[model samples]
Target chain A: AQSVTQLDSHVSVSEGTPVLLRCNYSSSYSPSLFWYVQHPNKGLQLLLKYTSAATLVKGINGFEAEFKKSETSFHLTKPSAHMSDAAEYFCVVSESGKLVFGAGTILRVKS
Target chain B: EPEVTQTPSHQVTQMGQEVILRCVPISNHLYFYWYRQILGQKVEFLVSFYNNEISEKSEIFDDQFSVERPDGSNFTLKIRSTKLEDSAMYFCASSFGQETQYFGPGTRLLVL
Candidate 1:
């Protein structure tokens, strides 16, 4: 079994400020972790993924996430937030070819 | 970049009516999937398809739900009878294998 938990239901950040969204996972096998962002009325866009590759993965739109095995965590981060960054973020894990998505974290960026 | 495409961006239906959602997965991709998210809920997997047959399905994929790759390029999900609880955003996705899956914009189904 594999599952992901997003720590925050909602997070607010001012434009140009740093952003962080936390996530943790539980998996029986080596996990494939992913971060996806969904803008309003839009489909999910893949942010980044960890498939036993680089521990620190970089994604589109200046976002990145670090996969920590000891902590059982894969937290998404951005050096600075933009108004366009407002969206819902999901942390997902793969199990037996099925994706298990976490309760999403909504990111609200204010100017 | 190749992407998954779905039809009927929004559909409203009456209870007990049948609704079919359609999708076209990325070309050359071998795996296809359907997922749904109720308002404010996590995205839940409904089913996965490969080789013209269902490879995996979730508990939510009951007898009322069926998937078909009727043609070489298109996949469809048919609900035998729509329920109020069935109102949700349904998404279609495709992947090369067990790798990252690309999602479609989704069909917002509203059952009254």
Candidate 2:
């Protein structure tokens, strides 16, 4: 079974500071990883995906994630946090055509 | 860019009533999916559709739930009897294959 665990249920950061949302996965074989963001009352938006290509994957809204095979981690990062970055983030792993999602990390950007 | 779309941004219904949630996938996409998230819960996959039939479904998808692509563009999920537990945000998504899926603004269903 492919599954993902989001380390933090909530993360708070000051504006213009770097942000990190941790995630770890367990998979039997090579896995596909993704990060998605959901603003309040909005849909889940794909931030980035890793499919055995480059380990470092860049996504929209100045977000990126690195797939670390040894660590079994794909952590999302942003150089600077903006107020609009406050949202719920989900770390997902794809397996057998379905997505196994993490509990989610709620990001809070403080001004 | 072409994106998936869903109807009835919000719906309130009485328990035991039937409800149909609709979706229009990207024009050229071949695979479609439905997922739901209860309040403060992880998003869960319900079912996946391809070639006018269900290709995969999760354990959460029961006989009470059915999916149809009645027309060339529209895909729908029907719940035969709505329950209070059914209240959640339902999302519709589509993909060119199975790699990446684009989601639509979900429909918030409130069962009273």
Candidate 3:
């Protein structure tokens, strides 16, 4: 079984500042993790995924996340936050073809 | 780029009435999934399908819910008798093999 936990339900960051969203996972087997963003009234868009291949994954819009097995964390980061980045982000875990998603983290970019 | 598409962006149905939601997955995708999100709640997985059969289903997918791929491109979810609690935004997603899943905009079901 695979489960993902998001550290925060809401994260507020100022424009031009850095952004971080924390996530952790518990899985019996090696897991595939992903981050997705959903804008208001829109479907989810994949941010990035960490398969067995790479620990550090880069996604679109200058966003990236690093998977740390020792810490059991996959935290999303962006060097400079933009107002358009405000959305609901989800951390997901998958093992053996089953995908489970965390509740979600709502990001607010304060100008 | 190709993406998943769903029909009837919004539907209003009375309690005990039946409803069918439709979706057209990506062209090259080989798997299909259905999910639902009640207002102010997290998205919940309902069922997954592959090889023209159900691969897995969550507890939320009860006997009242059924899925069918009647033709080459369309996948449908049928709710036998909707209740007021059935009001939600239903999403249809697709993927290839075990890869990333792409989702549709979702169909908002309002059962009165």
Candidate 4:
């Protein structure tokens, strides 16, 4: 069984400030992790994924995440937050072709 | 870039009525999926389809739910009977294989 947990239910940041969304996972084997974003009234958009390829994964909109195996963490980060970055973020794990999702973190970017 | 598309962005129905949600996946994609999110809940997988048959399904996809690939471009999820608990945002997704999936805008179903 594979599961993912998003540490924060909500995160607030001012424009140009750094952003971080924390996530941790529990899996018996090597896992495939992903970050997805959903703006209001929109569908989920894939941000990035880690499939044992690179420890550091870069995503669209100047966002990135690092997959730390020992810590069982895959935290998403952005150097500077923009007002457009306000949305909900989900940490997901793929197990046997099914995607198990986290509870999601609501990001609020203040301008 | 190609993307998945869904129909009936919103719907309202009475309990025990049947509802069908439709999707058109990206061209050349082979795998399709259905998922739902209740109010203030995480997205939950319902079923996965491939080659005109079901590849996998979750417990939530019980006898009331059925999936069909009626044509090369369309996938449909039918609920035999609806309940208030079934009200949620239903999403359709497709992928080239078992890799990353692209999602549709989703249909908001409200069962009253």
Colliding pairs, model 3: none
Query: Better model by DockQ, 2 or 3?
Result: 2
State interface RMSD in Å for all models. Answer: 0.6, 0.7, 1.4, 0.6
Best by DockQ: 1
| CA lDDT, every model vs. true structure | 0.96, 0.95, 0.92, 0.96
Q: Scoring model 2 with DockQ, what do you get?
A: 0.83
Go through the candidates in order and give each one's DockQ: 0.90, 0.83, 0.65, 0.84
Model 3: residues >4 Å from true position, as ranges? none
Q: What is the lDDT of residue B4 in candidate 4?
A: 92
Tens digit per residue, CA lDDT, model 3, A13-55: 9999999999999977678999999999888888999997888
Decide which is better by DockQ, 1 or 3: 1
Pairs clashing within candidate 1: none
TM-score of chain B of each: 0.98, 0.99, 0.98, 0.98
Candidate 3 DockQ category? medium
| DockQ of structure 4 | 0.84
Could you tally the backbone clashes for each prediction? 0, 0, 0, 0
| Candidate 4 per-residue C-alpha lDDT over B11-102 given as tens digits, one digit per residue, 9 for 90 to 100 | 99999999999999999999999999999999999999988899999999999999999888999999999999999999999998797988
**Tens digits of lDDT, candidate 2, A1-111:** 899999999999999999999999999999999999999988889999999999999999999999999999999999999999999999999998788899999999999
What tens-digit string does per-residue lDDT give for candidate 1 at B11-101? 9999999999999999999999999999989999999999999999999999999999998899999999999999999999999988899
lDDT score, candidate 2, position A17: 100
Candidate 3 lDDT score relative to the true structure? 0.92
